[model samples]
Target: MYELRDKDFIFIFTGPNGAGRKTVAQMSGETLGMKQVISYTTRAPRSAEFNGQDYHFVSRDVFTEAERNNEFIEVIEIDGNRYGVKERDVAQMIEKHGAIYLVLNRFGAEALKKLYGNKAVRIFIYADLKTIVKREEDRGDTPELIQRYTSHYDEEMAYKDQCEHIFENLDLAHTVFDLTKTLDDNYLHRNLVDKD
Candidate 1:
């Protein structure tokens, strides 16, 4: 088993909806002992989502107030809902847990990369259109929601090349295995060079 000795970094997972980004992020975080940084959103939670586990669900007014106070590192609107990551929250998490993971869109990933530079590891997760559609359908997404997600598929895929790592998530186990290995390798390589 490969263990990550160094954890002063940020892992930003960005991908289109229904691509298994969240699952991969959660699994990899668990396997590697990294903390997952939850974001705040104004969107209502889905059937099985918990308040803080899935997201920091908040009202539009509250979110707006935080945004006006410049509390977020990055904020974006998707499907008529606002989502953001607070700067203070990230700092606090990193203070407690050396490394943290975040599930964000391509825009949010880009913003984080700018802020953290090389400390931000940008990873893009993707899947075939058919698989994405099937997964969303299985999750009970409405046709309109599916369409909204698929419409942005091309745009999201285009950003994959910009990421430092790209994973095509087909089989969950295989993808998670490969992801953990890649993360371990990257960590080792970076630490080895730092010692030189």
Candidate 2:
């Protein structure tokens, strides 16, 4: 069992819809014993998604008010829906767990990185367009919505180079293993360098 020791990190997981970013973030959080940060969204919840569990579901008015109050670390509007990460949520998680994970859009991830500097690890999980389309369909997304989301695939792919780590989630087991191994290696390497 590889233990992370006293190392603390904030992982920002970002990918296009149906790329399994949330699922992977949750799995990684469980493996690492870190808390996953829930984002606020004005979009309606899908089947089986609970309020405050999957997302902090809110109305546009509330979301706008939050934005006006400067409560969000970052915010983005996608497909006419608003999504944001609150500063208080991240601060609470950091204070409690010393580590936190966020499933964020590119804008949110960029903002988090700018705010946290070396503490933020950007992980980009990706799959082929065909696989993404299939997964979106499997998740009960309408064809029209999937098409609209797919149109942004190129833009999402462009962010791959911006990430510190990239994982392909086609094989969940391998993906998880790769993430853990990378983290372990980085931690060990950092410790060794610090000792020297």
Candidate 3:
């Protein structure tokens, strides 16, 4: 197991579907020089998503086998597809980068927070239902998928208060700017405290 320092932050970004959580997390991580933690998923890749970059796409059998082996730190099933982060992968990233960000669902975020305590910073990025629907449609999501995601909007929203930060992602550029600024400030503060 990799030792965790107080200064090592695990940023967990989560929100309802089509809320732009992934994009915001990726952009903010890039700007802040934090490593992005790619999760393993049994779901098929989206049109623009790649096997390695976006997610380690795998078959259900493979995912089940990994789960049986206790390879995952946290796992959740959404829309009948399983997604999880490997424990070894997270330890490697933290060993290399000190800080890392992950785009996860509410369950996964909660699990990480429980494991890491305050070192886990949860950020909930969300938009209005109309905006979410529009974004999903623009992304060419099927009607069934769109409906399934939107139906869980309220449930996901209920988890917002459990997060450390909540942001309305109406504009991509502004959201990224705000997210990165907050992260940078926190990182600097943690380092300063560590030095003292």
Query: Cα-based RMSD of the predictions, in order?
Result: 6.0, 6.0, 4.0
Model 3 gets an lDDT of 0.88
Expressed as tens digits, the lDDT of each residue in 1-196 for candidate 2 is 1122255678899977678888888886776667988999999997758998899999999999999999998889988999999888887777778778998878888998888877889999999999999988888889987898788888888999999999989988778767866765774232212211
Which regions of candidate 1 are displaced past 4 Å?
A: 1-7, 188-196
**Candidate 3 similarity to native, TM-score:** 0.92
TM-score order, best first, reads 3, 1, 2
Best-performing candidate as measured by TM-score: 3
TM-score of 2: 0.88
Count residue pairs with overlapping backbones in model 2: 0
Return the lDDT, model 3, position 14.
92
Better of 1 and 2 by lDDT: 1
Flag clash pairs in model 3. none
lDDT of 1 by residue, 1-196 (tens): 1122355788999988789999999998987778988999999998768999989999999999999999999899988999999988888887787788999999899999988888889989999999999998998989987898799999898999999999999999989888888887876232222221
